[model samples]
Target chain A: MKTIAALCLWEERIAPRYDRSQKVLVVHLDHGKAVEASTIAVEHLDREELCKTLIAMKINTLICGGVVDPCRRTLEQAGVKIIDNVIGSPQAVLSRHLAGALSSGTVVD
Target chain B: MKRLQTPIPPELILDHLAVGVFTVDPDFLITSFNAQAEELTGFTRKEALGRRCYEIFRADMCFEGHCALRRAMDSKSSIVRERANILDKRNQERPVEISAAVLRDKTGAIIGGVETIQDDSNRAALEKQVKASYSFGDVIGKSPAMQTLFEALPVLSATDSTMLILGETGTGKGLTARAAHNASPRREGPFVKVNCAALPAPLLESELFGYRKGAFTDARSDKPGMFELAHGGTIFLDEIGEMDIGLQAKLLQVLEDKEFYPLGGVRPVKADARVIASTNRDLASMVREKRFRDDLYYRLQVAQLELPPLRERREDIPLLAARFLQEQGALEGHTARGLSSAALKLLMEYGFPGNVRELRNILEYAAALKPGGRIEPADMPRYLLRIDCPPAGAQRAAAAETAPQSDSTPDPTPERSETERKAVTDALHQAKGSRSETARLLGISRTTLWRKMKQLGLGW
Candidate 1:
């Protein structure tokens, strides 16, 4: 059962693009319930390094803003499912994701 | 009533301009967004302000930190006519031309960054412009890696920080060094190249920091070192990893103090030369092993650019080959014009261990073997035919696609896949999911193991 998800970030707000994000908020989900979350500095990492870090963290679903095709494909190839083009604050974004209402292109004010 | 013409605010003048304009604070949050910016990015000024500019326009460069505004701010220079693609509010691709610079306050302190965008949706103009800047100095590359490096060179050249260039053998380290020097503000200064591996410690020391008269038996007259000769210019240290640890300390002093002591002189002479070092060696490992100085390594790499080898960016092979062949043709009385497509395909399939230098040598050999015009596969060195490539149709399809390619396209034969699967699975089981051990047991490189795992859907 897949559970771990990562939300790419810019400060407290979800960055509009995955590649440009400086941080990622990693969350652990149990039976669709949010449980634990933490942030990892991701600004210094290149696309491949960023993918490797997430994969090492066992993240299966990545919730973020627009992802350039190359970055999305790289993550997908590594078995991390990407839900891109999302925008909102962490609380709002995580809430929608917990409700199973989060998807690509979701703009939560 | 006399008509009073209230002077139009300059802010309104900016809004009416055709070019898209925007400003970002130090944190990269949008401080202002103009009307033209709204039309180009599909994000209104209200929606953009206070939000990060990256979210509004998901540009390819932004994701990789190759941002134009970021570059301008870092290198304290302006970026003009750089090309980038972004996704609009509607998620539609918007091709844009960027010109950017750091924004300064009243006291000339950098407060933020400002950028102007020009619509570059005209494919014809984009292609034509791309061709003109395909090569920087003598280094030519159209691949993404080269393009990124090309953008970085100007940014790096503008600063005075010590630069360390990393690359494999024959990967144009020298050309890149020369290119950096040419583009740098110190272009008029003498560019000196010193190979650290070339001399013994004593000779190299004296050569670098010249000896005074009567300092040694051989020193009959006062002589200036490479450091002195390179004053007001750039000094390139090639193969810096091979620099002796003892000499490295002195070099570090020069880097830190901006001066070096002559072999026999009492006073420290000011060394005004800028330093750019290059090496094909792994300095990090050398530092770990204590063969290289850790402090020097840190200081030298304050700003570094790495040149990718030929095998990793195979898309550049054809372009590089054409340039080399054309130059070789001119050199050999027009004996070689170009390579046939079949010849190019064979060259692409081969992993060029020697990088660009090897390609040049091979072309020179072929040019000598063939009298004139397009060189065919038969005219090439026999050693280049070691690898068997996919069918021509598959290669064509790959060339036609502009998107990122899969791990390995034109799928491996079923027999090969079955063998790889069994070997990898067995190795993984034995290694207990340790990729390094699996690769070792299977006698394949680590990167190869990772690619096979992805291709076979055998993620651990």
Candidate 2:
């Protein structure tokens, strides 16, 4: 099944913490194939607003690093998969996702 | 203090330093992490090296364009000393003091950045003296009411009886419960909590007592409740007053029998858990209204403890305010150092309807509005300043109506500026009219204090 994922960004690397991320790279996938990708600025959004934005955008999963309860719970309740405490570039993480070898707390060099 | 003439290796010196030291490349990757850095951040040097600073440290300042190292490297500037909070590997939000400076080669080209970190958890506690003389867990107090409560805590924790904690909202009822559990014989066991008001009666009942597979339409497998999870430990039922009348009967049964039947199960499970309940509601009134069960109330209150509100313990205001100001971690920059005398006086005179929680909210709001330095009366919320300051121990502002009609009588309840003037005057007198000494007494710079004195016409 195809899905949409948002990779929290810090420059070119995945943001270490989702709560502090100012930007997110959203990628659309279809059967392990990349369909589309775009960058969205998220600095102005608070925790609630950020969750609402992700849910409203039809985002199915969030790829990021550390995430506390409030943000994690809100996203989880909205049926979004939160893969957290991850490290490495967004491209490498997304590639690993396609290879079916990615999960929470995964560290990619 | 004399400078040692001995020259030490930079690596040896960095390893021996008390503060955590780390250097990052321009790509935001960690180049080096010292021994102290590894211990303080709960990550080994091998795990931290070559990783992003944020991935290893997880400092709160790293998010939303506030990365301390990034800011220093980009601006070609240095953060000499700043406060931050970091989540360690244990998921503990530890307070840290950070200093970051951009690294430059001999050619003056920017290379990377170096950051030094100090665990400020202990320092802040000692510096503010919030964990002062009388503290039970994180709950701190020094008043007679609190002192008596402190004296009784040992006795309360020495037993295994069900304890009911009564207090107004946000009065540390949960904190007291935790303190009791920490001091109890079951300290090694699990501590579970459930807010009866947060869930519906049916869901709350399921949450308190386990259910078996096929117990209900959606019951896929065996699910253990909070009571089961808290085996050999303590279960804190927060806001127990909100428990439904029907569920209260079931709870009453559990308290009496120490065993309960999981839904749709024939076998009974023994509850080896100690129960501690807390509420801000008047359970007695609820009993009269038939909203709460009297049997359950009696069972829960076998060992009851009452917590005093913030107004009654006004003597601890300064200490609490100082602590709250230091706790303003999520703010953009440095937290407020301390409250000015006028601000302290204002806080003491005002009645806190929301208690300690409200006090913290007010200080956090003030600190966010105005970044670093001492918080003044002007920084307080308008709601706080709008209310009339009453005389100590008085419920209402009767001073203005009851005071003698003479300027010589002194303002029975002086306004903010008047209070500030009196504080300065007293400091000047104590310092023997020395401007520098007076400034030291008031915890302000000589120039700032002198300007205030001149502006207010104190004639010092």
Each candidate's fnat: 0.43, 0.33
Regions of model 1 farther than 4 Å from truth: A1-109, B1-129, B386-460
Per-residue C-alpha lDDT of model 2 across residues B110-221, encoded as one tens digit per residue:
8899999999998877866644447777778889888888878878887999999987665788889999999899999998988887789999988999799999999999
Residues forming the 10-long window of minimal summed lDDT in candidate 1 chain A: A65-74
Candidate 2 RMSD computed on C-alpha atoms after optimal superposition onto the true structure: 15.8
Q: What is the lDDT of residue B336 in candidate 1?
A: 44
- lDDT (Cα, tens digit) per residue for candidate 1, span B175-236: 98888888889999999999887788889998898988888788889999999999988999
DockQ of 1: 0.22
Pairs of residues clashing in candidate 1: A65-A85
List clashing residue pairs in candidate 2: A65-A85
Weakest lDDT window of 10 consecutive positions for candidate 1 chain B = B396-405
Q: Per-prediction count of colliding residue pairs?
A: 1, 1
* Native-to-model Cα distance after best TM-score fit, residue B37 in candidate 2, in Å: 4.4
